[model samples]
Target: MTTHHRTRWLALPAALLLALLPASASAYPNPGRVTGDITVHDPTMLRAADGTYLLYSTHGGLEARTSTDRIAFSRSGNAFNSPPSWWKTYSSGNDPWAPDISYRGGKYLMYYAVSSFGSSTSAIGFATSSSGKAGTWTDYGIVHSTTGSSNYNAIDPNLFVDDDGKWWLSFGSWWSGLKMIRLDPATGKSYAGDKTVYGIASRPTGTKAVEGPSVVKRNGYYYLFASYDTCCAGTSSTYKIKVGRATSPTGPYYDKNGVAMMNNGGSPVLESHGRYIGPGGQSIMSDTDGDLLVYHYYDGQAGGTAKLGVNLLSWSGGWPTAY
Candidate 1:
């Protein structure tokens, strides 16, 4: 096993130290208090080895923010000094969205998507950094992409490294739901041996508004968390986070009710409530305290501005409950 894998397993005990007492299921808890530079979209965060929190989000060449205590964040800079030239091929304006960051193989890797609004022609790009800081990333080009004629869209990339050292990337939007591809750990690119695109979740019958997938393993089950319904509409957005689980990383995921995720089945994790409107675009982080549900929500009190939302999760009954 690799040293990285060994370190991760040793840290699992602390990462799985969730709250024993579950929160009321009906009451969606408000986000934990945060201040300064909280406005963000599709935020992906990870605590560096030095204990500084690094956050990267959509736009502004993948805008960045840093926090010493995970509360008062300050805008650091963009991940890239300038948008890569290849980005213009998918997005005329060089817009990228929904970045997923991780520490693997002794390096910080980031996967982000580039595409124009309502377009299936999108590309997921990869980059690497030694320090997990803005302006230090070196773009490695596209990892996966889709054309207008493809059945699925390739945006919102999330990398999931299994317990046995296998890497899987889950991403998609609007066309045919979420999909996953095996990754070669050496290259951080798609595995040449396995070209099969696995469909993990979808909404086949109703609105195909499911996207932004984040996968994590806990208690012998692989949980798939995704956003559902329309997003980016501010106060009118119906975006919410939902979840399903399977025994394998490449899954036939089922919701709490045993309904298949491909058939519009997902148990709600977080939804629009009170001043927190359209809560979605979530990523799960294993922090010192516990598992955290980190995402963005439109602030009703702030004129529909997108802001960062953080809440600890409890795995009281084998399923995660965001509190």
Candidate 2:
């Protein structure tokens, strides 16, 4: 929630930020238009099993794109298309950043990012695809790593299975802001103990361009959601989209003015308009005609490139509003 209006330099070229974002974010649609031609970053969603609706993103690598109507997408490739072979040993060939998908043993896993970004040596890899089909990945290697320490650079990863089923995995950035533990539910790969439990810290200048962390749980509470500033750097990006809330599942959360995004403070659920530069890497899915807000923004309509938006969120009085 800090915008005194100063960051600008957008020369508008990537096809005009893709024709002023589907002709100005497609004004009013009962809430349902997000189309422009797939650019995705940090953004992630999955429903498959023939229902179709798979979007996943990340920068410098990872990428996966698709859409059933969340607004026209297509590029379903490079879920690390072909980078292993010891990937330049520590970071040059398989930088494959951000990739998160779920659906256990019956297979679909995903959860990627091998990293070198701000280096802690980085790693959080895993891949499987029982015909979830996106060129059929199958790595399943470093299911979680950390070589030295940026305190926790390991890379933005997210996974879930709560409500008592356990299986957790949130990640961190900026030395330590978001962190979680307990994982292992049937080999989601390691950790059921070194106990980090959960922690949040949205940047009180400890210098965390925040970092994408996503979670969900509606009515019973537990929201999380992070993206705070500076991502992908396409239009001098200074990202946005922040949130908090917690009824447990590791958090002191809070936010809609009750403050406490670990106290660094946060509130606005989404920001940036007119050109949508640096929106965020968020996630949300609910259905039955409810919440949507899947993310990735920065298209003054594709000239600033980096597409995919999909709003249609609501909760109004309890927060989480998007349109």
Candidate 3:
């Protein structure tokens, strides 16, 4: 969640900016107008029924922020004033990571990961809030996890509910790539009947850096989006967002070219170009304007500082294009 490295870089020259820009001109879309406490990582956002925009991201006790018109954001304390005591069972520091939040069953549900850096001994924990406010969440303990003996690292939890009312949780990082398991709609835990952990995406041969899985259903197809390559290196980071699709939530997802995602097939949704060095760790949210692609990018113009980057997504071609 929180990276240790500090990035420092000079701004791009005007001449080089034109050359580095995407060829189509429209290919390079600027992040939506936002200001005030925009520093964040792995951000997931939702508009409350009262029209308040709540944004939660990775940090100490899962940092929180709020927006009134979706443009300007301000710090609103953290989800927890102190780390949950049970967190020590999984994370050595008792600090949690990427938090996936959604309004489900008329209440706010958040699933997050707790683990040490580069360690497979990780766990995905759950929490709920009646009012989705800071210091109001109740920890529900671990939903799922993997020990050092397991091949897959359990982190970056994402909850997806299908139209038929089936709940699926997709999560993973490194080791064996992205994974999803069926969950009980009521408890938000693994479904009792189906004990299947489906493999959706992987980079088997080279760097197994693909992670941060988020699933969104658009036009009858379930699209799987994930972050690929090295992250947390600031401007030196190579993280980029990629996508694949399938009819079923538990997928043998394929890219635009019909290549299976399990074999490293993914179409680039967003990448480092121009001044947006390493744009990734993305989550999709349906806003009043349209679908918003929210993520953290190392700002090349600001010494590679991690900043919030949000762009509206256009899916006219049956594939997502960020603008």
What would the per-residue lDDT of candidate 3 be over residues 1-323, giving only the tens digit for each residue? 10111111125566876887666774656676678999998999999999999999998799999988787899998998888887897877778889999998789999999988899999999999998888889988889989999999899999999999999999999999999999998788989999999999999988999999999999999999999999999999999999999999999899999989999899999998777889888999998777989999998989999999988898999999987
Ranking by lDDT: 1, 3, 2
Clash list (residue pairs), candidate 3:
none
**Runs off by more than 4 Å, candidate 3:** 1-26
Candidate 2 per-residue C-alpha lDDT over 14-45 given as tens digits, one digit per residue, 9 for 90 to 100:
67667666654633222234554466677777
lDDT of 1 by residue, 1-323 (tens): 12343365456666353343245434787888789999999999999999999999999999999998888999999999999999999999898899999998799999999999999999999999999899999999999999999999999999999999999999999888999999999999999999999999988887999999999999999999999998999889899999999999999999999999999999999999888999999999999878899999999999999999998898899899987
lDDT of 1 at 302: 90
* Predicted structure 1, TM vs. truth: 0.92
Model 1 scores a C-alpha lDDT of 0.92
Q: What local lDDT score does residue 205 receive in model 3, on the 0 to 100 scale?
A: 88
User: What does the lDDT read for residue 226 in candidate 1?
Assistant: 98
TM-scores for every candidate against the unseen true structure: 0.92, 0.31, 0.92
On TM-score, who's better, 1 or 2?
1
